[model samples]
Target: MLKAILIDDEHDCVELMVRELARNCPQVQVVGRTTSSEEGFRLIQVLQPDLVFLDIEMPRMNGFQLLEKLDTLPFSLIFVTAYNEFAVKAFRFSALDYLLKPIDVVDLQEAVRKAERQHRIDGRQLELLKTQLHSHHLAEKIAVPYQQGIIFLPVNEVIYAESDSNYTKLHATQNRQYLLTRTLREVQEVLEERGFLRVHRQYIINLEHIQKLVKGEGVYLQLSNGVSIPVARQQKDRLLQRFGWL
Candidate 1:
């Protein structure tokens, strides 16, 4: 059984979560529960649980602050919060699991299963997550599902992304290409804000890698990697808008 702890500010939340864990996730055994962040911190040091269902908001210390206090973390944290838009965005980029309050049992179970699969948590990973959450910076890496495992690549190395039917192919700086099961649309949702522009329905090019733009009846983009992709006739305006040319 996975030893776990719950740390929330609300008494009702603590009660509900305990019930949920008992009813839904039998594999997780609740070793401790506390409504105080300070007490929660102390419990973690004493019990040293394998999993922690952490609440993001507390009276004295928020979730990030609590994490900063723990110098050594051996457990996986599944954050529970109401709506932390900014933090959630960072969490998605960092590939961290979080449950939104009014938490669904399905999502809770999924997080538990994921935690069980990844048995140990690295302290540095927690630090990275804290950095991503606290700073106005892009996530350090992105995870791409490969054959039987996931490949974590630095976000800066991405040169462009190509649509491979249903799968998206990630073209990186080192002449590496990874075919991801995720659709181009899904990849765009993650990469679009990070200086990537969808020049065509089939291609999303990295803005930083544009070598030159040749104007014609239709515009064409030459990438740093020596490949040119056509800008779709309809998306031409949106593409040009990136350079303030339209």
Candidate 2:
């Protein structure tokens, strides 16, 4: 049996999760439950469970705080949250597993099964999940509130992203530039895997569009469309290494 724990501030939420675990996650034997992060931390250290169903928002200490405090993460964390916007992005960026509120039986079961499979894999899944999440979280995507929302921009279409004060400007193919509400850091996280290289703190360029590297004049890059992007002196060597020139 897989040892497990449930941590949530709401008693009803905890109870509901416990019931679902009992019914669907037969492989998991819940050894502890708690509302306080302090208590949860103690239980985790003591129990050393195989799985932990955590809630993002809680009194006194949030789930993230609890995670941050752990000397060593004990088991697979399945974050439960009612609000899906901010927390979801964080979890996705961290490559951590989470379930949205009003938890569906199907999603819950899948999450449990994934946890069990991950446990068997013994760290490989964790690494892969982290990689995938990091990539997914950084991609240029828009989550509009309503009316056929959520637009995902293909990484290939992106020429470069520039920081605009608090926001970021996405320059796509065909000279189309879009003003995004998100910060450049967030955009960097998603595009790093898709050949988006941060040549400078304020600019991230698409590697696929690079046509040629001009050795002199600060190592400027000639794009496929004949646009030249100035490559920072520090970034030249790394870019060469990335292209297997070194």
Candidate 3:
């Protein structure tokens, strides 16, 4: 059984999570629970849990602050919060698991299962998450799951993204490409605010890397890397509007 701890400011929330874990996740044994971040930090050190269900909005010390106090993180972390879109994107970029408020049992079980498989986080991944959250700006780098580990890639290095069935292929600077397990739509949602535009159903191109836009024969864009991406008819106007051409 995976020993787990629950940390949240709301006593009621903690209680509910405990019950849910007990009912749904028999593999996870609740070793400790705390309503205070400070207390939670102590519980983690004392209990030495295998997993931690952390709430972001807590008094005295929020989740990130509590994490900073730790010398090392040896447990799997699954954030539980009512965080906004920016925070969600941060979790995605860090390749971390998060359960949104009004928690879904299905997602909780999935998170637990993932934790059971790989129950520890990379320190750099945590730092990446902290940097993005603390900066309150678009992320500079993204942790992409590659092979058996994760690769931290600069956001600006991404020149374009191609749809590959359920997966997304990322083309970056230095003539490199990576296959991400996430779908094209998921990739778009995270990269759109970071200067990427879905010009076609199969592609999301970085606006900054567009070298030329050919008008003839079903309009297409040539990127700095010399890859020509076709622009969907529906997205043509939006793409043109981005360059003040419409």
Candidate 4:
């Protein structure tokens, strides 16, 4: 059984989480819960839980401040927040798992399963997350899970992404390539806002790296890296509009 602790400033939120955990996750044993970040910090030290469900907003200290006060985090962390869309994007870039307020059962179960598999995010990832959140600006680095660990890659360095069956291959600067476990669609969601355009069902190219666009029998995009990518008939109009050529 995974020993767990719940920390939220709202008493109702804590109670609801306790009830939900009891119903959906039988493997998790809630060792302690608190409505104060300071008290929660003490509870964590005393209980020494395997997992912690932490709320991001709290009076006096808040979640991030409380985390900074700690010397080392030995337990897995799952952030519970009611932050805006930009904050949610920040969480994604940092490769951290967050549960939105009024948690969904499916999401909760999935997060717990992941915690069971990988105990916690590495220290570097957590530091990256803190830097982005504290600065109130989305960082240019994106954390991608690699092997059994994670890699923080600069978004600007990525040249293009290609679909490879169930996985997506990221082609970057310096002739480097990474095969991600996520699908092309999943990768597109993260890269599209960062100047990447999905020109074909099989390819996403960085706008900054476009060398030329050949519109002939078959439309193809010439990238700065010297790789030619085909453009889907349906996506050509959108791609053209992106550059105001339409």
Please list all clashing residue pairs in model 3, or write none if there are none: none
Measured against the true structure, the TM-scores of the candidates, in listed sequence, are 0.72, 0.51, 0.86, 0.86
After best superposition, candidate 1 residue 227: deviation in angstroms?
Answer: 6.0
Q: Which ten residues in a row have the lowest lDDT in candidate 1?
A: 119-128
- lDDT per residue for candidate 1 within 50-137, as digits (tens), equals 9998987799898778888987767878989886666665665555678988889998998898788665555545555677666866
Computed on alpha carbons, the lDDT of every model, listed in order, comes to 0.81, 0.71, 0.89, 0.86
lDDT of 3 at 48: 97
For model 3, what is the alpha-carbon lDDT of residue 28? Answer: 92
Q: Is candidate 1 or candidate 4 better by lDDT?
A: 4
Better of 2 and 4 by lDDT: 4
Q: RMSD to native for every prediction?
A: 4.3, 14.4, 2.5, 2.6
Candidate 2 local lDDT, 46-86, one digit each (tens): 98999998886788888767776776664777878886354
Give the runs in model 2 whose Cα sits over 4 Å from its true position: 120-246
Top candidate on lDDT is 3
What C-alpha lDDT, on a 0 to 100 scale, does residue 64 get in candidate 3?
A: 83
- How many clashes in each structure? 0, 2, 0, 0
**In candidate 3, what are the lDDT values of residues 1-246, reduced to their tens digit?**
999999999888899999999999999999999999999999999999999999988877999889989998989899998988898888888888899988999989988987887667888887888888888875689888766667889888999999999789999999998988678998888899898899999999999999988888788899999999999999978976788762
Residue 103 deviation, candidate 2, in Å?
1.2
